[model samples]
Target: MTNEELEFNNDEEVLTLYDNEGNEVLYRKLLQFYHPEFKKEYLILAEESNFSDEDGDIELIPMISTDDEEGQLLPVETDEEWDMIEEIVNTQMDEPEE
Candidate 1:
């Protein structure tokens, strides 16, 4: 789906993606934050019906970029980067939202 087609409900954002079998699946944006060191925005998403942390707060991180003609989502690489991102997310979640 195109960036302009993104839909938001309440405070969560929705993105449509295709599975290996090319079936459409919906994912919800849980959190979005910029990495100071990387200077890139990242999205934390959870798959449909898998939104709770009851089992575990499983999330996907995709680097967000608009420099391309269309928006781009890239996978996060390196354990160090993932660790930093997680730390940032945790820190932000602990604070009150304005």
Candidate 2:
């Protein structure tokens, strides 16, 4: 869905994706940014139901992006990709939100 078509609930954008078992799962799009090194766009998504960690803090999981036509969110593979994702995310977290 396009960004404009994204539905927001409680001030968060929600996207519905089906799991391996074909069950619908809801996730909140916490962040989206282009990875300069990888020349690809990535997203930080947290499952709605599992939004919080055991400590009741927001858990950001999965730095996902795929080149496939479907635009499916696939987990990034490789140390380099992971490192880049972490670095970008950390930088984002440190920046004061406007």
Candidate 3:
């Protein structure tokens, strides 16, 4: 994989992740917020068309970036953290853009 494919940029608004088996997956940025308790940055992403689920609902995946060349993606490890992130993303997504 090239360097470009391995990295994610907020300016680009889209992210591509490679699986362990070397398959390329894509996701679009839906929301980004900072966790007040953990003091970490997080992103909520909608899986791209090719990776979407059977019901056509855009699956949201929450991740934290390691900020390296590989752009390592890590999930919110704890239930509390996941709940907090989920609520924040949902609330933000429901608001209208001004």
Q: How close is candidate 2 to the true structure, as a TM-score?
A: 0.73
**Once superposed on the true structure, which residue ranges of model 2 sit more than 4 Å away at CA?**
1-12, 52-54, 67-69
**Model 1, range 11-94, lDDT digits (tens) per residue?**
577888777799998888877755556667677777866766697766654455435765667778878778876676666566
Q: Write the per-residue lDDT of candidate 3 for residues 1-98, one digit (tens) a residue.
A: 22232222333277787778999888888766555457666777876864457776667888886667976778879998888766666666676766
CA displacement after TM-score superposition, residue 91 of candidate 1 (Å) = 1.1
Q: Which regions in candidate 1 have their CA more than 4 angstroms from the true location?
A: 1-11, 53-66
What is candidate 3's CA lDDT for residue 65? 61
Which sections of candidate 3 miss by over 4 Å? 1-12, 50-56, 67-69
Error of 1 at 56 (Å): 6.8
TM-scores, all models, native as reference: 0.67, 0.73, 0.73
Give the Å shift of residue 14 in candidate 1: 1.0
Sort the predicted structures by lDDT, highest score first.
2, 3, 1
Native-to-model Cα distance after best TM-score fit, residue 78 in candidate 1, in Å: 1.5
Ranking by TM-score: 2, 3, 1
Give the C-alpha lDDT of model 1.
0.65
Winner by TM-score: 2
Model 3 is weakest, by summed lDDT over 10 consecutive residues, at 1-10
lDDT of each candidate versus the true structure: 0.65, 0.71, 0.67
